[model samples]
Target chain A: MTYHVHGVSASGNCYKVRLALEQLNLPHVWHEVDMMNGATRTDEFRKLNPNGKVPVLVIDEKTTLAESDAILCYLAEGTPLLPDDRLERAQALQWMFFEQYSHEPNVAVARFILQFLKQPGDPRLPDRIAGSYRALDVMEQHLATRTYFVGERYTVADIALYAYTHVAHEANVDLSRYPAIRAWIERVRSQPRHVEMPGVDQ
Target chain B: MTYHVHGVSASGNCYKVRLALEQLNLPHVWHEVDMMNGATRTDEFRKLNPNGKVPVLVIDEKTTLAESDAILCYLAEGTPLLPDDRLERAQALQWMFFEQYSHEPNVAVARFILQFLKQPGDPRLPDRIAGSYRALDVMEQHLATRTYFVGERYTVADIALYAYTHVAHEANVDLSRYPAIRAWIERVRSQPRHVEMPGVDQ
Candidate 1:
């Protein structure tokens, strides 16, 4: 079945689903949403995702899943992309939640403000940038001792985090001090069937 | 083996773990962290969670899991609290992710700022409250036709969302307009072995 993905190409959350689908060799069709133009705010888009967020994976006529990380788990299930062990699977989810809660809100929002909204002087930028570094610090500390986020293997957890961290510069967050995360990012990039997110400059 | 959970009682994130344990009849010990006194910031707490967040579930001496939803998934695995079907599991995770990203950050943070930090005048409160209502609108729309967050049965998704949502008034966000959510909250409260999170008034 061809998965129908409604997303914005330049969005890291959307990029996560695209990357996983490519790596897993899943059949999929991408439908780009004009988020900046309020495409997601339309009633038709809200039917796909009531939250009006990007990266909605329509599995079939009767089934649609939102939330990029959840979509990753769905697409990665029974594949090498998802861990086999129960604890390891939970650990994978741990990092994904961390990405959404601690990392993305800071890193992704900062990038959105700067790249999409073009509002460098926005008041929320300082807190977002500072929080981005804090999230990076936690990631750096974790990656300092491991090859991957879970089970020493590349899993959806890695994909979830690598999405925004790789493009943090667009958020005005520097990675110079996070040597471990930098190395990890390269490792993620070198993974088989890895796909690059379209640069924000696009 | 008994699980050791380190968390703060007043935190909705931590209460998620406690509630799941109680309802699932799992053997666990709770170690309440003095978050207001900087207990999570201590070096010892960092060993439990580098992120320095609460709701750290220690499965054993060598294994620890952070992120409240991840812990819920861990504790709920193989139990009825987690769904058995692949799509249903992903659906459960979808709501959980939604809770973390779209719901908790606003609802939970607003509650924290007000009840815990006693910051009624905090500048972030307005945006937080507005975001909380937007999140509630999504939940209310979803719950308008469903008995639970997933599969018409109680799952961790409900547990995850029920944490902060039931206490949203503490965030200074009203629920009078969200009849569906209010009804669902009552349904969640009626679940077997349901435990109350200590009131902020305590």
Candidate 2:
């Protein structure tokens, strides 16, 4: 049976799952939801994910998974996206956690507020921008010596972090200061079967 | 070489790494970093983790892993904390993600502000309370039927969520409204070798 992923096209959280699916060459159907219409808050949709979040993946007949990182790990297992060495795998998950805690909450939240909520001047904006740069600066320093977030090989850790930091400039978090991060982003984008943001005019 | 974890006693993120180590019966040295003294911000510590975050796990002579969830996964691999079933493992990661995105930011941030910053009426407090409850409500509903967060047994996902929600009330986000969540918290704590939050004086 074909897998089904329920998500919005423009959501980076959802895009993470889509990018993994594309990279894995996994055939799946995309069921688009109009998040702006509160479609995810509906009773039926909440049944699939009580959190009312997007990027729910239904596999086979009996299994469904939520959380983009979970989905990424699930699909990437036994594949190149997950490292074979245990220590390297741990490093992969390390960066994934960093993306969730430091990167996503700052960069993604800033973008959400600026682009979606149109709250560029929201009192929280300044702190969010500051936090975003702090996170980026950390990433910049780390990437200065490495090509990927984990081992020498590419892994889903890069995917998780790349999902947002690639477009961080949209939120006005400057990337010019981070030359290595820019190069790493380009390296990630050049990977085979890479998928750009869903709504962008490619 | 013995594993070494650099952490602060009061940090649940650090506690998570400790708990996983204990559960796995891994012998390790605990190095305390006084965040209150700005120990983590030192150049020496920053060299270990550019992000200057707590819960850095040093293994062997050259391998170091950061991020609590990532450390948990690393130690728990080949153990019961992680499931072998593909879909079940994904479910475990799903809860880990929920803990990060929905649970930790609210619970941890609120606790940090109220306990450390001493700013109860801080403009961010109200939203933190609201968001915490929203996440708790979803967790409560999920636990209404399942004995654990994922699979039929306890996993790292539970450990990840329990580390924070167990102390959430200190932030004024009541779990009383979510009876199932309250019960599950007890169930997790009841596990053998379970470690209470550091400084709890239990």
Candidate 3:
């Protein structure tokens, strides 16, 4: 049975799952969750995921998974996206955790506040921008000497961060200074079967 | 070679690795890092982990892993702390992510700001407490009818959240209302080979 992913493509958290599915060539159907409305907060959506967050991956009929990075780990298991080497696997997770704790909270949330929430003047914007740059600096330094986040090979670590990072410009996080990150973004885009977020890349 | 864990006992994120090590019966040594000072920002620590976060697990002196949840996953591999079933493993990770994304940033940060950072009157206190309570509400609802975070078994999911949750009171986010969470905390504490944060118990 094919997996059913419930989330909008605009969210990096959601886009990570979509990117993993495409890279792994997994069959899945997308069910968009209208965040602007109270769609995800409804009782039906709550039953699928108690947290009421988007990007819920429903496997078969009974099994369902929440948390985009965890879903990426699940989908990329045994595939080249998730490294088989023990240290490499842990390193991938290290970057994934960084993406969630450090990177996404800054870039992804800033993008949401800017693009989706349409609150450019929000007081929180300043801190988010600062946080985004801090996260980006870490990535830039790491990518300076490495091709991918974890190993030299492309993996879900790339997919997880790439979803929000490549579009951080919308959040006013200027990438002009991050030459390594810019080059890495181009490398990610050149990957096979790459998919773009809706309303982006035509 | 035994693993060398670097971080102080005061941090919940660091305590998570210590808990997993003791529970899994894995032999390891502990080296405390003075996070309150500038220890984490030193050149040596940065080499250990670029992000310079605590709970760095050095395996066999060659493979070092950072990120609390990721280290838990690494140490718990092939052990009962991580389920063998595919879906269960994903579910384990799902809660781990929730702990990091939803739980830790709220209460843990609040605890740091209030107890460690020592800024109880800080403007961010109210929001952190509110966010912590919101995350607790989700956990309370889920645990109302369940024994553990993922499935009925005690797993890394429990370890990840319990590290901060059991000590949330330090942040002034009272848990007197969350009876389910209170009960679950007792259950976790009663597990075999249960461990406590350093300096807390004799």
Candidate 4:
């Protein structure tokens, strides 16, 4: 019973799961969905995930998990992605939560509005950009002293944040302003088996 | 080195950690930070958590964890709060993620704006309220069939969601429309050693 992950190639939410699976060296199939074609809204996909979101993980035909962070934690368990030390594990989760609450909502949403929605100069753009910068400043301050989000080593928490932060500049979020975060992004990119988001390498 | 959680009673995020501690019957001291007084902005508190958000769980003298969900996972680890089965664990994390992305940002933020910020019926209120209802609708639909958020029994996932949804009405989110969620709220309340959020019992 091979694991299966359903998502498109370009989604950061989906990239979180993909990065974890690859890092863990887990063998799985990528059931691609052309989200642009409205494949995710189809009744079949809705049955798999009622929220009709991407990056649903199906394992052994018995357990189907939705939400990218959940899928990352699920696959990363018992692996290096999760720390064995109890406090370190908690710290990893802490950063993961920050990724969701502070980082993703601002950075991802800003990128969505700018790139996907093509609303670069919309009235909401300024505030969204400001919010993204605030989040980046927070991350920059944290990463200023540490190599990873938690502990001395990389974990799923890093993967969760890296999924979107790396592409933040694409949305006009000037990474040059945050030297530490920019350096940390390079560190994450240099990891073994690390894969950049589609078209990013090209 | 006694375990200490740094948080105030009034915060739902803090309450989630406190509830987990009480549910597990873990002995811990509470070091309250008055966010209204800007205690969280202090340098010392920021060192414990660069994010400066509570509750920060300090275990022994060397280990400290931040983020409510992370603290919940940390304290619940190796305890009954965490599911042993891999699939069940994944499901627990899935709901935890849902609580963060779908539930908390809407429900909790609405409460913060209305209850604390005293901005109820503000121009932003309608959209925030609508978002909360959309999340509630999703949860109600899921709870319509299942007793708990994940497995047949309650897990930390329930504790995470229950922390906010139980008090959602105060934020103008009428749970009465969702009988399943309302009933599930009662079920969670009926649990042994259940602790209510501050002012909730009144």
Best-matching candidate per TM-score: 1
Clashing pairs in 1: none
Tens digits of lDDT, candidate 4, B1-202? 3579899787788898999889889898999787777999899998787777878888866667878888888889898888878778878888787788888888888888888778766777777778888888878888999999877788898999898898888778888789999899889999999987886322
The predicted structure with the larger lDDT, 2 or 4, is 2
For model 1, the stretches where C-alpha displacement exceeds 4 angstroms are none
Q: How well is each residue in A1-202 modelled by candidate 1, as lDDT tens digits?
A: 7889999999999999999999999898999899988999999999999999999999889789999999999999999899989999999999999999999999999999999999999999999999999999999999999999999999999999999999999999999999999999999999999989997667
Which tens-of-lDDT digit does each residue in B1-202 have in candidate 1? 7999999888999999999999989898899898898999999999999999998999989899999999999999999999999999999999999999988889999998888889899998899899999999999999999999999999999999999999999899999999999999999999999999998767
For each candidate, what is chain B's TM-score? 0.98, 0.95, 0.96, 0.94
* Interface RMSD per candidate (angstroms): 0.5, 1.0, 1.0, 1.3
Between candidates 1 and 3, name the one with more favorable TM-score: 1
Ten contiguous residues minimizing lDDT sum, candidate 2 chain A: A193-202
lDDT agreement with native, every candidate = 0.94, 0.86, 0.89, 0.83
Candidate 2 lDDT by residue in tens digits, A78-148: 99899978888888888888888888888888888887777778887888889999999988888888988
**Clash pairs detected, candidate 2:** none
TM value for model 2: 0.95
User: What proportion of the true contacts does each candidate reproduce?
Assistant: 0.96, 0.93, 0.67, 0.88
Highest DockQ: give the candidate number. Answer: 1
List, residue by residue over A44-119, the lDDT tens digit for candidate 3.
9988888889899998787788999999989988788999886788788889898989988989888888888788
Question: Using lDDT as the measure, what is the rank order of every candidate, best first?
Answer: 1, 3, 2, 4
